[model samples]
Target: MSEPPASDLTARARLRMAALRLFAERGFEATSTRAIAAEADVSHALLRHHFGSKDGLRRAVDDDALSAFDRILAEFDAPATRQGLLATFGTVTARLFGADELRRNYLRRSLLEGGAASGELFTRLLNGTRARLAMLSEGGDVETGAIPDSEAESDRLWEPYQVLFLMLGPMLLEPVMRHTLADPVFAPEALHDRSAANQRLLTRGLRAAPGDTREP
Candidate 1:
């Protein structure tokens, strides 16, 4: 297949970004094609030429946002020990969420809105978490007996969900968190601190030491 012209790629990116911003701020149901086009400073006809419609633009945005998670998961090409996996996940999560406010907000909105696209994104994250946990378990990084009975009874079924929540809970509750804490949670300093704290929790949970009784 022939690649699109450079101008076409640029326009498509602009339109997708515009749509992402609007969707995050005003929501999919309320954002309009013309409004997105105007935000992009492109004509409505140009947006249609690139993305077909508002829904198409949204799908593009979702794909773009989800692609980051895909890249993060791909970083685990080789199985890592429990501490190694936690460190990698913490670094990537901080980098991903701290880099772009708009992208972060878009993801938060998508997850909170709950739709087909949102479900797909959440499923992808959850599946990725499970895969990483499996890698640790299979690599003998996680001692099965060390896991608490509450988590191990169901074969550690809820571990993935817990990990996912620790990773994304701030994004989902940013507004309330900011208000309550009186700080921008995604700010670089705060994000780094949050990542470190989350990694500590994971480290405690996945520690394989025989006598360490630290709670995660």
Candidate 2:
């Protein structure tokens, strides 16, 4: 297909940004193409012509977000030691969770209302991140390793999921944790500190596990 004009591309980008913000604020089921179009100040026909449908637009947003995350994560070279792994993970977690308020809001909305799409995106992100972690953990034991490549493929596959869940738990549970906990400590800044602490604990535990000979 011939390349769309630059103006069209710009419009598509605007629509995607507008849709993402609106969806994050109002949710997927509640947000409409017309509303997104209006927010972007573009014609409804332009949105349809560019994205084909709301689902298409959502997928595009998901893809772009993930791609951007990947790009940011590419900066850190994988680490071999458990401490290094934790530090690496912490760095990445900080970047992902430290996104601007708007993006974080949108991501929260996606997690809440995007259903299968969100799950798929989460799976993809986890798997990709796990692979990187595994690569980083080369030469380390399954128990002590950051990613445990020696484990069964099924177990190995879950590493990224575990890491992601751990990283995302604070963001996902902040509301409930804040409500139920007497002294709430789930704020983003606090989560970052806790994540670092958890990583240190994980590294120590891993190093202490039976059959693990890795030195501190």
Candidate 3:
């Protein structure tokens, strides 16, 4: 068999990146392969040759995002103090929220739509998040004590999801949140500041209590 041509590979990568950005912005249904090709400055035929279909392109984007998130989560070290936990969460929040518009758009699509593809991506995200939180709890770094085993047995364990959501949900909801906050003292900068403050509060609230040694 012949090796794949370098130009073809480059075109495929470009297509994937373009699709990711567009999907993040316009969502899957709204974005077409032709639009992705246009965004990448490639041809529709080239996109189809590389990705097979729009669903295939979305899967690639999902894989790319999930891999990137895993790398970010892996970098998180367990925080040793309540303040440290707050700072760690703040750092994570900032990084995720700071993602380029395209990535944010793709995430929104996954959340708003529910089907095999979106469901798989959502499951991967949730699992990755929980695993990272479990690492924090295991290391005894999170200020919050080990979540009680009985409570954690629920399918929708709240703490991990709560933490992850607080970090990301605001960005997803920014448009609506911004409109809702359009009162006195509700400037965009102030909203961001308040969001940051809320992250700190959540970090502090989630920390293990002093003298609690139970493991998650």
Q: Which candidate leads the pack in TM-score?
A: 2
Residues 54-163 of candidate 1: C-alpha lDDT, one tens digit per residue: 77888799788777766665565332344445555656665677666787888888888887877987887788778877775775454444667765667567767766
- Candidate 3 clashes between residue pairs 3 or more apart in a chain or in different chains: 24-105, 24-106, 143-207, 143-208, 144-207, 144-208, 145-208
How well does candidate 3 score on lDDT at residue 131? 79
lDDT comparing candidate 2 with the true structure: 0.69
Better of 2 and 3 by TM-score: 2
Ranking by lDDT: 1, 2, 3
List clashing residue pairs in candidate 1: none
Question: Model 2, poorest ten-residue lDDT window?
Answer: 139-148
Model 3 bad stretches (over 4 Å) = 1-9, 81-87, 140-149, 152-156, 180-192, 203-216
Clashing pairs in 2: none
TM-score for every candidate vs. truth?
Answer: 0.73, 0.74, 0.70
Candidate 2: segments with Cα more than 4 A from true spot: 1-9, 135-155, 179-192, 206-216
lDDT of model 2, residue 109: 70
Give the CA lDDT, 0 to 100, for residue 213 in model 1: 46
Instruction: Summarize candidate 3's per-residue lDDT along 108-214 as a digit string, tens digits.
Output: 66777777887787778778777777777788744544557675566237655665566566656766775666542234465467655664554445465765444
Better of 2 and 3 by lDDT: 2
Please state the error at residue 128 of candidate 3 in Å. Answer: 0.6
